[model samples]
Target: MHRFNAYRIFEKEGQVSARLVELGIDDLDPGEVLIRNSHSSVNYKDALAATGTGRVVRRFPVIGGVDVAGVVVTSGDTRFWEGEAVLVTGYGMGVEHDGGYAEYSRVPADWVVPLPLEMSSADAMAIGTAGFTAALAIMRMEQNGLKPANGPVVVVGASGGVGSVAVDLLAGLGYEVTAISGKDDQHEYMRHLGASQVLSRHTLEMGKKPLEKTIWAGAVDPVGGEMLAWLTRTMKQDGTIASCGLAAGIELHTTVMPFILRGISLLGIDSVQCPMALRRSVWERLASDMRPRHLKEMTRTIHFEQLPETFDALLKGAVKGRVVVEIQA
Candidate 1:
């Protein structure tokens, strides 16, 4: 029972608080596989759970992180073995169980995926849950007949982790990308990620009609609320919009004209409980043809000690792109 460091969150008297502490393997929730965590990433969901901003944590005094990449220390399941590189995202990692904000993570073997070939632990964490969600959105869109030739794609909240990765992945796949963000400072960064157009959130007019003049052929909408309603109104016939996050607000107010007249598809991406088969397929695609071209540029690695403060910036929408935590280092 080796002692390792973990960041645990607690709820006391209707307040949420978290602090780093040391624990043995027996202290963690039971699982078949043990991972020596090398890297993890800070995502929006992780921020919410850690800070109690969204009340996502199901259990108190649990380690807080939704993404983990590491080497297998031991496994009861035959699918994995010692020294194998692996990663886990979603499937109740941070909320329902002790998570990756630790030097070691013991998780159900069914929840793990072998790290893709040629993908290092650092690279896997850089993608993490954010990139996985973005990729899942695109996967569904393509299944609905979305292609680069369909027309330009628009990504809302384009300066954040999922948005940045979506922009890069879409552009890499030859789709013209239009990025929309409120941060003027991020426009150039979006352009660098291969966006053909960057629209400021402040200047755009969200028309009030059930159906406005069609613009986008597809949309990666992480921001809900008014922005999502606008997309539903403005999508072209047969267009598909992948609704991933509710960062702007969860309430979507719109008419049925877009669905009836235009035949639009609103795909809800649930990365948390994604089927293990599709999850593995998506991870393979992420490491291969769909790999993000700007991962290094869009990501910065932070030491494990810097984890707690990163959540505040994330929740405030001040952080840009991805923040990978070097847990082992």
Candidate 2:
């Protein structure tokens, strides 16, 4: 047994507020492998958990990071020996159980994925849940006929975590990418990720018409609500829109014209509860063809103690790119 620092949140019943505390390894949940967590990344879900906003956590006194990449310090399962590198995401992390925010985490062996040959622990966390979701979106799109040759693909929320990685991966695969973003400061950054063009979010705002001129052949949307509805109407006939987030809102007020008249396909991208078979396949693809080129350039690393301030900014939409936390010294 070992001792380590962890950022914890304790919430009592009938209370909306959470008490922040730093605790030890003895506090972790039961599992087979004890990982000396090296890195973790913040996601929208993490932000929700951090701020007690979304229903991201049903359990009280939970650790609130959804993605972790680290080295195993002790293992009860043969598949992962001590010192082996691994990563974990989804499967109730930061929600139903303790998660990656701690310097040390004990997780069930089944939830652990060995680090890919192409990725280091830090690199894996740099991609984290956001990139994993992005990759899953692309894979689902391809399965539904959104091929690389399917004209041009547009990515909404283009400067955010999922958007940034999606732009990089799609462009690397030779797809023509048009980025839609509200932040003009990210224009050069988006271009660096291989976006052929960047459209202002205001340009796609709700208008009087039910349908406007059709443009992109496919789309990866992380901003739902009006942005998603607008994309559905504007996408080319038989186009596919992979809807992943609800950063804008959950309501999708769209006409049936886009689906019935244009034969457009709206694909829902669900990273959590994705079947194991598909999850394994997506991870393989991420290790191989789907891996982004400039991962190091896109990563933003922070120490564990800095999480509070960083998470505050992230909740306010002030953060750019992925924010990976270095947990263990």
Candidate 3:
């Protein structure tokens, strides 16, 4: 195709603007693989980048999508071949590089992951980077000695994409899950995702002590800040906390008592710049047993034209679960 539709973000008058535009292949950044992108998904980071609400995009005039899955149309790398199913996520995508909110994406070979046999492009995107991060969190927690027999796993921000997937994966793995969210309406939705119990965000009151009740054996925290501090205090001895996003806030004001006295581990999860070997392993797990059973139910698919409106919803915290963007018919 000589030209295709893409959602481009541009900086003008010191303000960022985004729109659907027509662009040619040459407009894409030089890369080894040219993918006919079928689906991409909106993460919290994508919303930040698209709306310029945060310093998510370092460079101007980039596509705003962190996750992409499609068919490889051309390949300069020996490991990838034409017509092979593949995906690209993270590693400066939609930030410093042109991303997946388009009909086509040309990205570096190192950033491309061959889609697993059990996963379709749409399915891969349905999970997307959000799910990938959730899986990575679980993997790291497990490596740190967390197990189904340990106790309960609490998922903060449990109504969002990453949180919902974390709930499902942890429950599917035989761990009891307590989902915590600020949205009152999402209680039933979180339960359906296999959360044994759903708690309001307010229920996790900030205790003024260095340590609180040891309730959680592990936690998948995307809503950092005070919530993370709370988790750190309430975790069981030797428990692990996989900290991801900062939907609540970024600051963590807490004493070192939990880490020193309880030996609790705080694992930082960064989907971007995650090593390829671990990335492949995580994707493979997501395509298999760790995949959310309610994958389709947990996702909302929209076209590329709907991104502007969707970005607003995502930024305002109105969108729930995953928002998958269909890049092709």
Candidate 4:
């Protein structure tokens, strides 16, 4: 049996640490299919898990990555065949279960999603969990009556992975996207992602009122905390906000005035446990009309060995866009 390299995380004495180790296939957690992983991408959650900055990993000595894309090397499940391209995200990965920061990943067939529309594994990982969550948010918001003609849509935390994808996706669909970012350096990058307007998080007034002047027709908010509360007060009548992350803080301080008076809706986006049918459909759309136009330009790849040194930038919110880890070739 051949051994492969994996970035494994361990928790001991209430402290977490990770390092690269060699492990044979038998050493990994058992699953129906074994994938020869080609690429994996860094999400904010991945950074948090590896750095022990967040309580994300539930199991000790688990591989550390939330998203992986590659070709099936072998499958005990009849649903998957060798050489088929697939990707897996969320659903206990990098948490209670071993994940994709390895040369190979073994996962339950149920969690596998076939690479949609002839997409390469690199492209799949480029989009990764972040892009999927963004697309899912847009899908949910549209079902709640959001559209290009519904007026402007604002994306909070617009320089991060999900936020960047949201800006590009919303703009590709014709919505006038206003990107909110704290980084002064990323305003031009935001504009390049199709943002009609870029708002400086440090300079913009969030305003103090139960209900502020109605501005956004819709909002893709991942920042939470005060930003989410601000979004609730400023949405147009019957507007929707898709809450995806808590990068700023989890606590939400908002009144029901917007919900009751303006008929605004707050839709929580749960990409981790999203239903399979919906997950597949959203990914199909992502490969089609909803794919980010600047995906290649917005992404950069690093060799697998570079993984350990890359998380600090993501944790510090310094990275501009997506970072794909090339595990093979």
Q: Give me the candidate number with maximum lDDT.
A: 1
Q: Model 1, range 65-113, lDDT digits (tens) per residue?
A: 9999999999999999999999999988889899999999999999999
Q: 157-196 in candidate 2: lDDT tens per residue?
A: 9888999999999999899999999888888999999999
lDDT agreement of model 1 with the native? 0.94
Which residue pairs show collisions in model 4? none
Residue pairs in collision within model 1: none
- Runs in model 3 lying further than 4 Å from the true structure: none
Candidate lDDT scores, in order, read 0.94, 0.85, 0.92, 0.92
By summed lDDT, the worst window of 10 consecutive residues in model 4 runs over 303-312
lDDT of candidate 3 over 154-174, digit per residue (tens): 999999999989998999999
Per-residue lDDT value at 114 in model 2: 85
Q: Write the per-residue lDDT of candidate 4 for residues 1-329, one digit (tens) a residue.
A: 59999999998899899899999999989899999999999999998999899988888989999999989999999989999999999998888788989999999999999989657889888888998999999999999999999999999999889999999999999999999999999989999999999999999898889999999999999889999999999999999999999999989998999999999999999999999999999989988889789999889998767776788888888887899999986
Per-model C-alpha RMSD? 0.7, 1.7, 0.8, 0.9
